[model samples]
Target: MLPEEGVNAVRVVVGLLVRGEYEELETLTEARRLTAAEIAAAVARHGRDLISPPDAAFREVDAVAVPHEPADEHAFHVEFPLWTAQDGLSDLTLGLTVTEVMDGVWTVELDGVHTA
Candidate 1:
């Protein structure tokens, strides 16, 4: 998949997570690999580390693509420098793996969330 497409997919996934839209988020993930409940639990466990509100809007500040073997799988490390009215540029990043399942179709897997 193209880097731009991967970035766009990451943005959508992050947006859903921020907005607490886990059900929709599940649809974008790898088939049967992730569930809405799992996503909610992950957020509940680690959300405090984030500087942005649950409903805060975000943008992709930077992204790096890592090529994988077999030529169909790629990993993207994306940073969204989240901020708030009180704090500027909080360090939160997301790791996502994008796999091409078919000719032009892809699936995403949330590797993890990180803070710095």
Candidate 2:
């Protein structure tokens, strides 16, 4: 099972893709290992009429916002922009941070922690 925080982030990204918002889905440096952009693109590309442009159609994401999670192991978190010209969906700015809380663990252990 995936960590709830990671799962929630994946869900939100997948939800955004399902809604046809595949523009400017940049991957943060920290999350390079997760291949978030590739995953998002794959999820976004799953449907017909969903075009993966040669280049991102939206503005460049300045940063990624990572939601709070446990204080152990490693994790990837995202930040969405405040507002965007794209309708229906929220602005897609912000940043993503991949953290390594502890060494040697392949994934974070969020069993005992609460996410906010």
Best-performing candidate as measured by TM-score: 1
The 10-residue segment of model 1 with minimum total lDDT is 51-60
Candidate 1, which segments miss by more than 4 Å at Cα? Answer: 31-34, 47-61, 67-69, 72-75, 79-88, 100-104
Q: Give lDDT per model, in order.
A: 0.59, 0.36
Per-residue lDDT of 5-112 in model 2, one digit per residue for the tens?
Answer: 454343344344445443422332233333445545543432322222222323332233344457444555444332223332342322334345455333221111
Model 2 weakest lDDT span, ten residues long: 107-116
Q: What is the lDDT of residue 97 in candidate 1?
A: 67
Residue-level lDDT tens digits of model 1 in 1-116: 24556555656776777677878877777435568887777656654533333433333335566675667655545555444333454555555666555555556777555565
List all candidate RMSDs to the true structure.
Answer: 4.6, 12.1
Misplaced by over 4 Å in model 2 are 27-116
* Top candidate when judged by lDDT against the true structure: 1
